[model samples]
Target: MSDASGERQSPAPFLRLVRGNPTPEEAAALVAVLTARARAVQAARDAEAAAPAPRSAWRAPSHPAGGHPPRGAGAWRRSFHPG
Candidate 1:
């Protein structure tokens, strides 16, 4: 049937088949099962979105050249220069 704008639109084939075929009890059961499954999926997505993000373990390294040379600096310099 045509909608407000007068453009004709037909019901989907799967919807027409479902509407025409199922008994009342079967239709109710199907609706209940699908509704429960949709609620479960939405709840799982909400829980995941609310969860906190994990933090990284690494920290920023301290600078070593500001008059506080790093450990083993003397050994490293002597090894490199061989003087």
Candidate 2:
């Protein structure tokens, strides 16, 4: 897991395999896969942030006053402001 910067990070198994004495090729492959996955995930997150958010069906309707209505009042309007 990298921070904001795009720096290389060591995988969990890399350290374990080092202590357990893994083969050189296996270690290299593990590192490659982990780094690729990290980059892919970061790219996906960046794309999502850049993309416009989809409209939500569950989103509250905009009020004429240009702000959200008081919470929990949508179902209680009739009782409080009887017609």
Candidate 3:
């Protein structure tokens, strides 16, 4: 199938499965399974959205350099770049 722009369409997995024209009983089972899976995904998403944000233990270091304090006058050569 094509879309309004006349580009070839990609069939979703359910549509591809339906193209085989399953028996009525098989079709009913497939629908039930798909519906259950969809509900499970929605429930998981809702749970995640309702969960509390994580608490952070990290705090900015007091060093004027913005991160860890310099070890010595030549520390810049060995130290990671601080923001």
Candidate 4:
């Protein structure tokens, strides 16, 4: 947002100490944990976004009722499609 002169306004603080006062080191530790957790969550999101989407059941290879086709010529190709 801006004022009458169009000067940018700073937003409210993202973190606030509502309870007991903590030493600088303790506060840093808390912030480190929160920041690490946030980064880990973001990394997971990034990995999921980069992953290939799952194939639909219709697009998935058809397995034999017995699980795998018997060993024989064309068995490999037969396992991938419905007869």
Best by TM-score: 4
Candidate 3 deviation (Cα RMSD): 10.2
For each candidate, C-alpha RMSD in Å? Answer: 7.6, 12.1, 10.2, 6.6
- In candidate 3 the C-alpha lDDT for residue 22 amounts to 82
Order the candidates by TM-score, highest first. Answer: 4, 1, 3, 2
Per-model TM-score on C-alpha atoms: 0.48, 0.44, 0.48, 0.60
Which candidate leads the pack in lDDT?
A: 4
Query: Taking the tens digit of each residue's C-alpha lDDT, what string does model 1 give over 14-47?
Result: 3233346788798788778878999999999999
Clash counts per candidate, in order, are 0, 0, 0, 0
* Stretches of candidate 1 exceeding 4 Å from the true structure: 1-20, 59-83
Question: Which lDDT value does model 2 have at 42?
Answer: 100
Candidate 3 residue-wise lDDT, 1-83, digit = tens: 89999999878765346367689899889889889999999999999999998755463344334456579887886576653
77 in model 4: Cα distance from truth in Å? 23
Predicted structure 3, TM vs. truth: 0.48
Query: What is the overall TM-score of model 4 with all chains considered together?
Result: 0.60
Please report, as a residue range, the 10-residue window in candidate 4 with the lowest summed lDDT.
63-72
Off by over 4 Å in 3: 1-18, 59-83
lDDT of 2 by residue, 1-83 (tens): 76569777766653355266778898889889989999999999999999998877556465333334445557468545545
